[model samples]
Target: MKQPKGVFVTGIGTEVGKTVTAALLVRTLKADYWKPVQSGDLNHTDTMKVRKWAGEAAGTFHPERYRLNLPMSPHASAADDGVTIQLQDFELPDTRNFLIVEGAGGLHVPLNDQDCIIDLIQRLGLPVVLVSRHYLGSINHTLLSVEALRHRGISIAGLIFNGDPHPSTESIIEKMTGLQPLFQLGEMQALNDECFERQVQRVGQACKTLLDGL
Candidate 1:
């Protein structure tokens, strides 16, 4: 079977469940996972988490292009690590199955002096799955996020709400952006492969066609 275009996983903001959603997608589609630029936390990186859960999913976990040392923005961390990030530095992994590329931070997050996550998305030509968690000002953050991607003509695969549902917030974003929600992952006390696989059963059916079409 021919491989489908990868899904680029991004979030409305930092600490908003991008990695969790990406891991679920990776397992759901049995897709390869890649996080291009890791700013820090190499000990427990997103790639590590995906590798841990994607174990029999046959998902290949690709290493980051830049493994910066400090837990800071890619730009600062790169500088601290004495390395410069360039657009030419990133290369998409070769895989026959679906691919799930998780972005760092938000759309505007800087990889270097000039390039940001949005730019990298454009460069990679991957569709996005924007993960949004409900917060006090999340409506604004989510809207602005949708606008940024739309403004750049990026394909938004869908939105995935990661915490307790806030219908009002979710509704407005969907209503305003006309972007569908693939799944609403509720808060769970324990997070593991078993838990993620359970969520996949609920979300996989909904997201499969959309991701395959990408």
Candidate 2:
């Protein structure tokens, strides 16, 4: 079977909705989701949440090897535990399907003393799905992030505007940057049945649109 294309999901900053967006993407495609490095959570909170949302089987999600007690940068959390996050330690299952690798934080997040999240993505050579909030300063942050990815020769599939209830910021981003807004995830305080169903439909449509281009 042909291998599925891989997509890396990174955010402008923490709480920018990377996990939720990733969950949506994976559920839409019914693809494997990988959380490469998790800190601050003891039992892979995001992975578990995504699995539940996706209705994935028990083994569909892969947890990162490095799980730190502190809710800080992977580097800092690893240091506190006297462990170093090594690139070689990062591995994904060899499956013939799309894999969504969710980054811990923004592009520049330090994974270890010598390497950052960008380094890992570059090494993986996976196209990125940037997740940014539709708020002030989003344009600057998104542009800089896109430029950085370009500098590293990374391919960006597109951008996902998380929590953009209004189209004000989306219009500006498209007009100014020329990057297509792949999805406009609405605000969800809780993952109720109604919200989950809506999210699933929206994400499923977005996935169809994205994959149609491929």
Candidate 3:
């Protein structure tokens, strides 16, 4: 069987809007969404959020491999639940449509004593859509993230900034990494389906070439 075409959605740090970014990607591509390891907030998991945000048009929302209950790092959360998250436990859901696999946190997020989030990404062999929201030191975080991915021989599909555009910060990152952001999503006041649909079109249009390449 042919492997699914997909992109790994990860962030420089937590709460950098990786879920929103992944949902937008799903809407744009009509891809299947999966979160291999859900650390906490099982009541409202990332899979649920993406499905609600993008609506049915976004495609399927797959169940997580491990849904730990505590709202903490996967390693700690799994330990709290008396579970050891072995990567072998994960299996990519059968899908022909493009897939959007959202990661728990940054590349350094630990899944087990020896495996971090990046290791899972590497194992899956999927290119990444690295989300970097503008913050005080986001430029450094963003660059370092790209460098780390490069060091691991993982392909970065593209950068997708999730907050206000900081031209100075963005420009430096571009110059240093030579990777222009595929698209930048600003904060939304009213995050409704219609609003998210508009964002899907906007990012879809602006990043058409990038998406095409992917």
Candidate 4:
């Protein structure tokens, strides 16, 4: 069978709008969404959010390999739940449709003593679509993330700025990283079909080349 086309979605740090970015990618690509490891908020998992926001365009919602109840780092949560997350535990879901894999926290987020989210991304062999939200120290964080991925020789599909754009900050990041924004998503007043669909209409075309290359 042909492997599905996909990209891994990661952020500079936690709560940096990775979920929102992933949802946008899902809607744009009309892909399947999967979070291999969820470290809490089982009541409102990222999978649920993406499924709701991505609307009918989203394909299957793949089950997480590990669901830890505490809303902490995956390693700690897995330990609390008496689970040991291994690299081998993650296998891409069977889907002919494109797959959008969302990561927990940042690249350095630990899944076990030896492996991290970046390791999992490397293992999966998918290019990354990094989500970066502007903040005081975001430049440092975003650069470090790009550096790490480059060090690993991982392909970065492109960058996505999740909220309002900061021109100076964005310019510097682009100059330094040499990565232009695949698209920028403005702040939304609410999360609804209208918001998602509008975003899809605005930025969906920017992703076409990435999808085509995949």
> Which one is best on lDDT?
4
For candidate 3, the lDDT comes to 0.88
lDDT of 1 at 52: 80
- Among these predicted structures, which one has the highest TM-score? 4
Q: What is the TM-score of each candidate against the true structure?
A: 0.95, 0.90, 0.96, 0.98
How much is the lDDT of residue 4 in candidate 1?
49
Give RMSD to native, each candidate: 1.8, 2.2, 1.1, 0.9
lDDT of every model, 2 decimals: 0.85, 0.80, 0.88, 0.92
Model 3 spans with C-alpha error above 4 angstroms = none
Pairs of residues clashing in candidate 2: 4-97
Q: lDDT by residue for model 4 over 111-135, one digit each (tens)?
A: 9999999999999989999999999
Give lDDT tens digits, candidate 2, residues 1-214.
Answer: 4444778999887889998888778777878888888898776578877887766522367756677889999999999999889988766657776788899889999988899999999877788999988667877888788888989999888788887465776777678768888878888878754576678776777778777665
Q: Please tell me which model should have the higher lDDT, number 1 or number 4.
A: 4
For candidate 1, lDDT tens digit of each residue in 3-98? Answer: 346889999989999888887777778888889988888899989888786658847887788888999999999998888999987778877767
lDDT value, residue 183 of candidate 1: 85
TM-score of 4: 0.98
What lDDT is reached at residue 175 by model 3? 96
lDDT preference between candidates 2 and 4, better one: 4
> What tens-digit string does per-residue lDDT give for candidate 3 at 46-137?
88889988787788889889989999999999999999998878767789888999999899999999999999998888899899988998
| Models sorted by lDDT, best on top | 4, 3, 1, 2
